[model samples]
Target: MSGRQTSFLAQALQQGAGALRSRQFDLAERIAGDILKSNRTDRNAVLILAHALVGQDRAGEAIAPLERIARRSDDGEVETLLGALLCKSGRAADGIAQLRRTIARRPPYLPSFQELAGQLSKAGQLGEAISVIESGLALVPESVDLKVDLGRLLHESNEFAKALEVLTIARDAAPGRPDVLIELGRVLILSGDYTAAADAFRHVLAQRPDDGSVRAYLATCLLEQGERDAGEAALRAVMRGGPHLLGRAAFVMAASSHGRFFFDMSEATKFLGGKST
Candidate 1:
């Protein structure tokens, strides 16, 4: 392209990006479409259009534009995104294949591994999901996100010991990370170590004081340890935190070892009021 044409395209890309950042999906889509009309293979234009479509809840429509770029470009990020969009558009097998190809081509690209493992897990291929994450860790040993994911996958597979070990490494690598702490807390709970679980949850609460879900988990740990009074107080506090917190607290309660179920505030109130539902 000539200097003037290149300059024009650059300006148009800038405008589209600004529109996207400002959440003006319609304007961004229009700007990207105008750029693509001049050069359909333009990477920036394709990405902008894809993002705009996704922002408008038209994710499936973004797939064709992304695929157009993928055909001409070996860009790992683009292909990884295309793979995710394909999965979201109900083409999981094709998406998984695309992600595997991307990872084979760009082994160090983290998103390909993450996306592939996520898709595999969702497809009930849990073993492969674990292997994919382990392979990613081999390539990027210092990736906290990969470690956290591996830990979660192991936990889901009922490999609590392995999950706890992986999460411990992740916690050490990323001290004060809320996600790592939260996962560690959950693994500890499932491992039948309520004290350690409560400690882990406390660390997360120290970081996120208003987190009712963490509070609920902490209460479960306390109750498991026979600290009924403290646990009840925490549950009551979560109940008073409005509907969202109350629902989350109830979910945690039902999922934990206590096996309690609370459908609404009134039910929760009745249980804590000594009716013990």
Candidate 2:
């Protein structure tokens, strides 16, 4: 391409990418289509077009553009994006196979494993999701991402003991990791070990003192263990916090008054279930 043409294409690419990021999917699609018309083989333009289509709730339309790039580019990003698109578009089995193939071809592949596990879990293939994450962990034993994801999946499947084991390993692997600690505390809470869970929550609070959710969790542990005064104090502190914290506090307050506070830690603390605004 001529200098001016290349410059123009680059500018178009930048604009399209920015538009996609800003959720101006229609504008992004227009720019990406223009770029692809000038150069059908432009991988980035194809990717942008695919993304815009998917953003616009036309994930079905994204397949062609993604496949076009995949046919010519051996890039991992293309494979991952294509596989995830396939999964989101209701071709989960094909997506799972492709993601597995990508992982097999390259050990410790991050995106493929993450995407495959998430899709499998969402599709109710709990065993497959666990297997995928286990395979990734085997390849990268120290990967906090793989371990945490596995733990959370185990938790979702109601395998609290197994989830606790995995999360403990992840916590030991990286003691300073807040997410691992949080999951660990949650599993402990669900396991009927309120004291141990409270200790874990305290450890996390030491790390992230301002986390109102964690504070609420600590309060729950204390309350369950018959420390009413301390729990109510902690909850009152949450009520005095910012908007999100106040919402959580209100949830707990209302749940307590309504006798709905008997839910297990997962149900009680889940932002989804309580959904405090």
Candidate 3:
């Protein structure tokens, strides 16, 4: 390629990346397609096209371009993305192998490992995902994100106590992080520690007063503790502040009441569409 052609390709690739970041997948793909039409082996064009395809949920079409790049480059990130795309496209075994190879060749890149762990978990390879994440944690023990991810995987596997332990550590490390607090609260609730869960939700509410989800969660904790009136008050407070909170609060109240009739006849009539006509 001439200097001008190379420069044009580079500019197109840069524009494509920007489009991808802004979620303009169609524009990104168009730019990538133009570049690829001229230089079929352009690595940047291939990578960008593959990413755009993945973003557009066309992972099947992304495979050929990704495989081309994977064959030509030793980039662990590329390998990881290809693995994830493969997994998303139902090629689980191939995806797992790609991720494993990338992890083996490269040092512990947290993002890659996290992606791999998620894909592995989805592929019913929970043991492998846990083992990989645990290994990564050994290398970066203080990483709150990694801890949270491992905790989430553990929680998904119904290891609620272990998830709680991990999330608690993450919350202590990043005391004011809303995400960590939320996850900690979730695990606490799952572990049947309603009181602590409520406390965690309250901590989050202190940091984010406008968070309707936290308010709803706190109300649930209250209801779970047999504080029906208090829970109802909290839910009412949430509903008053934001109408969107009403749906969530109603859901919590419904679940809490075990779908039983807790309302007066008039209120029940309203919910039952005016006595079922």
Candidate 4:
């Protein structure tokens, strides 16, 4: 390529990456398209375009470009990304084979296994995902991220008991980490142990006093246990402190249970300084 053309191509790639970071997938794809139009053989441009397509939920269109890069590169990251895109596009079997090949060649790259686990889970290959996660745990036994992911997957698969076990271990290992605590609390809630879930949420809140989600979860547990007044108080506190809290579902349940008139007219207005309808 000529010097000016090369410079333009590089600038296009940079702009595409910037757009991707900003979550402007359509713009990123357009820039990537321009780069590919000039040089279809540009592997980096193809990979960027494929990623943009995937981000835009156009995974089917991503397949060809990603496949081309995967075929030409031995990079495990590239293979894993391509496999993930393929699986997301509903080519589960092909994605699994590609991921397995990549893992077999590079076992130390834990993210590949993590991505494969997610794909397998989404494909309803729960057993396979669990097995892959277990193998990854054996390889990197101290990875808190992997353990948390496994616990979440187990919970989603309705293996609640196993989820609790994995999350408990992770919580014990990483005490005071809000992510671990929140996940453990969520699993406990899924298992219908509302009191335990509430306690876990409380523990997390003790560390992060401003966490509206934790407070809302605790309020939910209280409401579920028929502590209507306390639950309303907690929910009001959350709304007062974190007005933009995203746990409105929990608040709504608490509000409804306490009688909408008292919740909306009395507590909400007092705490939040606005009428609640």
Candidate 5:
């Protein structure tokens, strides 16, 4: 292509990218399609088109164009996205295979590992999912996201100690990350360290005070630790969060009644009887 053509392609790609960021999927799709018509092999145009299709909930349609890019180049990111799209389209086996191939290349692409691990987990291959995450951690030792996944998987597999250890490292690496803290809090709860779990949840609440789910978890930790007044107070606060939190609050109340400390039934009835707040 001439310099002018190259410049035009660049400008079009920029506009398409901006449209995608703004969630103008139809506009982005049009721009990407026009660019592809001029140069069928344009990688950015193909990616933009795929993203636009996905944004519009047409993930299956995005797969073929991504595969077209995959055939021309060994782009691991594209392969990862293709694999994920295939899974989203109900082709899990094919997607898993593609993701495995992408990871086997060891191309420093973190999403390949994450997507493969997630698929394996959904398929009930927890061991393989854990292995995939561990492999990714080996490749990217400093990746807090990988560590968080490892921690969560470990917790699911009943390896609470290891999960706590991994999440602690992740927390140290990224102290204020809500995801890391949430996973850590869960592991702590499993480990029967209610105090530590409460601390973790508290940190997250400090950052996201309006998060009803976290508030409920914090109430659980408080109740499990036998802090009745505080736990009840927290539960009431959760109830006040609105109708969305009612079920969780009730669940916490019921759970506390059978946990380390029994919640008084009368108090539960009294609390549930009132309007929220």
Candidate 6:
């Protein structure tokens, strides 16, 4: 291509990137495809195309384009995307290996570590996930993202005290972050500290009052504390708000009542009054 054609291609690639920034995935894909047709080796275009596919929920389609560029380029970031896409497509083992490779090859990309840990968590490898997150935290101690992941994995692994401690650190790091507060509330509930759990959930509700899930969680805390009236009211509020009942209302109750018993059961039964949902 002449200098003029190369210049045009660069300009077009920039436009494609702009489309991605604006979340115009279809247009970005088309422009990226146009650039690649003229120059198949255009790394930026391939990356943009892959991002566009991912934006459109086509992570499976994104794998090939990203892999193509990843093989030819030493860009650790692009390789991270390939690994993330692989994980999204259910290739957990491959994704984890590729992500580890990406993390090992170049600068410590925080996202790659987080994504790897999340994939490990989903695979029920909570120990591995905790290790990966702790590794990330060692690299960037103040990273709220890594801390949250660590806390969640600890909670999922049934280490409620450890989860609460980690999440408290996260909350202290970002005092007003709702997500950290929410995680704190969850762990508190698991540890049978319903009062503190309710406070945490209520703090979140103060910031986002209409969050039905949080309201439901508050209800759980109340019910678990033997405050049946307050818990019932919270559950009723959720039924009036939306369709969710797990965090919105029924999960804890069902657990306490046994079997499929929930809000639908008689109010005078066990968990509430004794009922089935």
Q: Compute each candidate's TM-score over C-alphas.
A: 0.85, 0.75, 0.79, 0.73, 0.87, 0.79
Candidate 3: pairs in clash: none
Tens digits of per-residue lDDT for model 6 on 107-153? Answer: 57888888888888888888988998898888889899888888889
lDDT of 3 by residue, 47-127 (tens): 788888888889889888778878987877678888888888888889888888887764666777888899888768888
Least lDDT summed over 10 consecutive residues: which range in candidate 1?
A: 268-277
lDDT for residue 219 in candidate 3, whole number 0-100: 86
Per-candidate RMSD vs. true structure? 3.6, 5.6, 4.2, 4.8, 3.4, 4.8
* Best model per TM-score: 5
Clashes of each: 0, 0, 0, 0, 0, 11
Error of 3 at 251 (Å): 4.0
lDDT tens per residue, model 5, 1-277: 7999889889999999999999999999999999988777788998899999999999999887889889998899899999999999999989999999999884578888999999999999999999999999898899999999999888889988899999999999999899999999988887888898899999999999988889889989988878877887887788777766666777787777433222564455357543533
| Sliding window of 10 residues with minimal summed lDDT for model 3 | 268-277
Count clashing residue pairs in model 4. 0
Q: Per-residue lDDT for 62-156 in model 1, tens only?
A: 89888988999688888998999999989988999999999888547898999999999999999999999999888889999999999999999
Report the candidate with higher TM-score, 3 versus 4. Answer: 3
Q: lDDT by residue for model 2 over 1-277, one digit each (tens)?
A: 8999889889999999999999999999999999888688789998899899988899888887777777885667778888998888889888877787777766456878888889888889998899999988888888988999999999999999999999988988898688888888889988978898888888888888878899888887877777777777777666556645655764654444222353444444442233333
Which should have the higher lDDT, number 1 or number 4? 1
- Candidate 3 global CA lDDT score: 0.81
- lDDT winner, 4 or 5: 5
Model 6 global lDDT (CA atoms, 0 to 1): 0.81
Error of 6 at 128 (Å): 1.5
